[model samples]
Target chain A: MKLNRTNLEQRLDHLYDVIVVGGGAGGLSAGIYLQRFRLSSLIIDKGKARSSWMQSLHNYLGLPPDTSGRKLLQQGKKHYDSLAGDFLDGYVEEVTDAENIFEIQVKVGRQNSRNVKFYSKYLIVASGIIDHLLPLEDMQNVYDYAGYNLHVCMVCDGYEMTDKLCGFFAGSEASIEEMVFNLSWFTPKITIFTHGLFEVSGQMRSQLQEYGYRLVETPIQKFLGENHQMTGVELVNGSVIELETGLISMGARYHNTYLQELSLEMKGGNLVTDKLGRTSHPRIFAIGDLKVGLNQVVVAAGDGALAATQIWREIRKDIGPRKWLMNLKLPT
Target chain B: MKLNRTNLEQRLDHLYDVIVVGGGAGGLSAGIYLQRFRLSSLIIDKGKARSSWMQSLHNYLGLPPDTSGRKLLQQGKKHYDSLAGDFLDGYVEEVTDAENIFEIQVKVGRQNSRNVKFYSKYLIVASGIIDHLLPLEDMQNVYDYAGYNLHVCMVCDGYEMTDKLCGFFAGSEASIEEMVFNLSWFTPKITIFTHGLFEVSGQMRSQLQEYGYRLVETPIQKFLGENHQMTGVELVNGSVIELETGLISMGARYHNTYLQELSLEMKGGNLVTDKLGRTSHPRIFAIGDLKVGLNQVVVAAGDGALAATQIWREIRKDIGPRKWLMNLKLPT
Candidate 1:
C-alpha cells in the first residue's frame, strides 16, 4: 500500500518486522524479499535516490545497456507492491533505538506536513549518497549535463568516454591523484580542471607533466553545452577548451545523519558492515552506498537480499516453529 | 561472439583477460562486466545451470514474478553478446595454473568432438551445482514435476508451499532434522517421507508426533498426479498419502572438479572467498553457487559485478597509463 495521510495514521502503531529507510533499488529489493519471506516491511523513502539521476545503466547484468535507472526502480516498486509490501514517501528525520524496537520519526509531506513515529523490530539503512557537481554560478547548467556527458562515476561511465577528448573536473588534489590516472585507461586526451578549489603539489605537477596532461586552475564561468551534451568549458580568464566528454570527480555527501545518536561504527564516511550488511547495532543493517562496498546498482541489490535473508533467519529461529506456524499467514 | 568448431581453432592461441567457467547467471554477469570494462572474456559453459531448471523465479527484483530462470539467462546472454563477450557451449575438463596465466582444457561437442585449450590471465569459476533428485525407477516422472509444484530449495520456494499439505522427502535423517522444522513456518501439515533410506531415531519420531506430523517410512511405488502437478504418492503397500506440495531435501553435486588441481580454499563444498569473491589464488575468482553465499540469481549477479570491478582495478594498476592508453581501443 502507498501510505498517505489517511493510511499512515493507522499503521503508525503497528510494529513492522523491518523498516527500510530508503526506497531505492536496495530498499525495494529488501522489501520484496522480506515480504516474500512472510515478514512485514515498511519502506520509508526520501524520494532522492542517486539512481534516479542516472540517465542510462550500462553494466547491470540482464538489462539492456540503454535502460535507465529510473525504469528499473519503477519496475521494482511495482514488483514490491504486488507482494503487498507497504511503501511510504516520507523523509526519516530521526531513529531512536528503543531497546527491542526502533522508533522512526518521519515527516510526510513537502508542505504543511505532519510528523509521525513508527516502530520496527529491525531497520535497514539504504539511504544512498549524493554526488557533488561542479560549483558553477548557474547550477542548472551543471544539472543539464550531469547525468549525460558529464558523468560522476568512472566505474560506470568510463566506457562511454573511451578515447574522447575528456575533461577531468576535480575538487581536491587527492581526487586527481586517485582517479585521474585511472581515467587515462579509457582516454589519453584528458585536461584536468581544478576549478581553483585546491593547489597542486610540486610532486604531483611533475607527474602530471610527465604524462603530458594539461592542468587548469581557473574557476569556470559556465559550462558551454547544448542538449545535455557537454562540449567545452568557458573559464574565468575567457579561454575555451573544447572537449567531447566530462567527468565530475568532485566528492559526495553521504546521507546518514538520522542515526547519529546511535553512534554506530564508521569507516570514514561509510558505515562498517559485515558481509551480511549488519551494523554494530544487532538489529540495524546498512546496505547500498551507506555501507563500505562498491556503489553499483547490482551490488546494492545483492546487499539487500543478503541482509533481508539474514534477518529472516534470525527472526525464524527466535520465534521457533510452533509460534511461526500459528501466527504467520500465507501471503495470498 | 559465439565460438564454434571453425572459429574456436582461430582464437585458440589468443589470450583473454578472463575466462569464466559457466554460462549461468554469475558467469554471464561477470562476462558482461568484464567486457564493459574493455577486458576480453570468454565464458565456457557446461550447459546445465541449476537455475535453468527453475520453472518460475518469484524473488528477482525488477522482474515479473512469473518469469522463468531460463528467460533471465536468455536475456543475460543477449546483453553479454551486445558487449562482444565470447560464449561457447563446451564443458571445461581441467584447469592448469601456469603462474601468471591459466590454461583451460575444454571438450567441445558431445559426439565425435575435439578437445581444445584456451588461455586467460584470470579465471572465474561460476560452474554451479546440480541438485540430486529422487532415484525413482523412471527419472522422467521425477523431472515432469521437479521444477513445478515439487520444489528443491526451501529458501526459494518455501512461500509457494504455504498452508498446504506438504510432503518433505529427506535423503538422510540430518536433512529432515534441519529442514523439517523450518518448513513448518509455511505449513504445519507436513509428512516426513524417508523412502526407506535412513532410520529415524526415537527422539525425532517423538518430536514429529508431538507436532502432529506423520512419518512415512515405506518406499513409494509411484507418484500420483497429472499434467506436471503432484498430488500424492502410492506406497508399495498400496496406500496413498495425498499432498498439496512436496520438497526434495536431497543434496546436490558441486561442479568444481576442474578446479581440484588448483586446491583453492573450501568451506564445506563451497569456495571460501573474501568479500570480493577472490579465492586463495590471486588470479582466480568464484561466484554464484560455487562461492559461499546466498544462492539467489540477483546475489550471484552482484557477486559478478564485484569480482569484475576488483579485477579491473588490479589490471589498471599493474598495466599503468601509457600502455593502457595506447593499447586499449574504444569498445565501439
Candidate 2:
C-alpha cells in the first residue's frame, strides 16, 4: 500500500459528517443509512465484531430461519459496500471531543503501520461485545452449534428447549444460582453442573431443592453429543447425565476499551443513551451489545440505523433546512 | 359479545407487549423482531405504509435485489405471524401514557360501537409517514408502480436510475427549490417538472443553473407509462417530457401522534431515543420510522430488537440479572 496524502481538506470525508466506530452489524447498518441520507461518513472496524464468530443465528428476521452468525455479518458488510459507504478495516485508537467535532486517532496496520487522524462531526459506537467463552478441550467442536444448541441469551432460545433435558454449566456461584432460575422459562428438567466448585448459599440450596433440580458439582470429562448437538455430559465422577440442551452462563466482556476515558452512564455494563441512539455526549453514540440491552445481531444492526439517522438529522440541522432539503433528493 | 370475568384479562385478541401504531414496513418489521424477542406486541395499521403499496424494493438488502415492496411487507407480516406477533386492522384515536403503561385507544369497527384500548408497557411507533399523493383524474394508476418506477426515498431508489432520464415532480415552488438539489445522488441527467406552481426565484434559478439541471413548470398531467414502467409525463401545455423514472416529493408527515403525550425529546418529526433505545421519558421508548432516520423495513426490525433488548436489560436490571438466570438448572 502506498502512503497517500489525506483525501483533501474540503472533501467532506476528511471532516466526516458522521464517524461510526467498531463495524459490527450495528456500525454497518448505520453506515448504510448515512449513505442513503447522502452524508459523508466512515466506518472504522478492526474486523473483530463479536457477531462474526457466532456459529448459528436462529431469530434474525428477513433472513432464512437458522442462519449462521458469521453469514449475517458478511451480508451486513455487503449491504454497506453496496451503498458506497466509506469504511476502513482499521482499529480506532482514541477519540477526543470538541465543540461539534471529534479528533480521532487511528493506527492503520499491525506490522508496517500508518497514523490517520479523522475529524468527525458525530460519532456512533456500533462496536458489539466480546462473549466470554470457556477454553474447553474442543472449543471449535463446542462452537459448531453455539447459537443453536449452546447459547447465551435464554430469552432468544429458551422456548425451543421446551420439555427437553438441559444443562447449565457455571464457572461461579452467582452464575450457578442465576442459571437455576433462568431455565424455568421453558422446561423444568434442568441439571446444573459445576466443575468441582460449589459456593451455593443455604437459602439457594433450599430454593433449588424446592424446585426439584439436581445439582452435579463433579468435574466434566467431556461434552457428549451427536454431530454438533449437545446430547449429554460425562463427569469425572464416572456419571453420565443425559441432556438435550446446554447453556453456559459464564459472563460477557464488552469491548468498551476506548470508552474508558469518556465517562458515560452505564447500567449492567452498557452505555446508556436516549432513544435516538445519542450518547450522553451529543456527538458520541453507542449501539449493539455495548449498550445496556439485548445482544442480538438484528438488534445491533437496528441500533446502527437509529444512531446513523440521528446523526443525519443533527448534521442536516447544521446545514440549515433550506440547504438540507435542497440536497435531500438524489439527482438522476 | 360475552365478557368472561374470571379469565377476563387473558381473553383478549388485542393484548400486546408494545402496540406499534402503523402497519407499514417499519411496523411490520418491528412486530417481527418484537415477536422474535418473544414480546407480545400488536401493529395497529391505517394501511398507508408507503412501502406496502410499492410494487418493488430495490435498496433493501438480502432479497433478490429487486423485490416488490408489497411482497416484502407481506413477507414481513408473515415473518411476524410465524413468530406469533399480532396485528389489528384498526385506526388509533389517541394514546395515553399512564405511569409505565400505554393505553392506546383504537377504532376497530363502524360507528355506534365501543372502541378498545390496547394496553402495553412499551410502545414502538413504527407508525410511518403518510405521503401526500397527488389526486388527479386517475389516482390509482399513479401509485401502481411506486416502488418499482415511482419511488419515495431517493437513497432507496436513486442508484436504480443511473444513466436514465429521470424527472423530479413537485407541487410547489418551495418544494421544487428543496427537492431538485437533493436528487444529486442518482444521476446528473435530471430535470425539475413542476406541475403548474409558483415561479422560481433568482437564487433558486442560479442554483439550478450551477447544477446544470433543467426546470419545467406547467399544468395538467397524465403520468404515462407502459408495462408498469413510467415512460414520461404529458404536460398540460400538451407537451410530453419523455423520462424513465420519477419520485413525488410532495412531503412525508410522520404521524407520531401516539407519542405526543410522552415527554420525550422530539426532533425533526421523530422521538429521540438514546443509543440503547431509551427515550427522554424513562419509562417510554420509540423506534423505527417514528424515531426518525433512514426508514426501511430491516431498519425498523432492527429497532424493534434493540428496543426489546434494551427493555430486557432494564428488566433484567430491575428484576435483577438473576431473574433471567434464576430459572435455569442448579449444579448437580
Best by lDDT: 1
CAPRI class of candidate 1 = acceptable
Clashing pairs in 1: none
* True C-alpha contacts between chains kept, each model in order: 0.49, 0.22
lDDT of 1 by residue, B1-332 (tens): 99988889878999999999999989988988898889999999988788888888888876778888998899899999998899999989999988798999999999988899999999999998988888889888888889898999888898899888989999998998899988888888898899898899999987887677788999987788999999998898999999999999888899999998988999989999999999999999999998998999889999999999999999988999842344234456
What digit string (tens of lDDT, one per residue) describes model 2 on residues A1-118?
A: 1112344223334688887887777787777778767777788888767766656555565665556667766766677777677777667788888776788877777877677788
- What's each prediction's clash count? 0, 48
The segments of candidate 1 whose C-alpha lies over 4 angstroms from its true place after superposition are A323-332, B323-332
Each model's C-alpha lDDT? 0.90, 0.68
Per-model i-RMS: 4.0, 6.7
Q: How high is each candidate's TM-score?
A: 0.96, 0.74
- TM-scores of chain A across candidates: 0.96, 0.85
B293 Cα displacement, candidate 2 (Å): 5.4
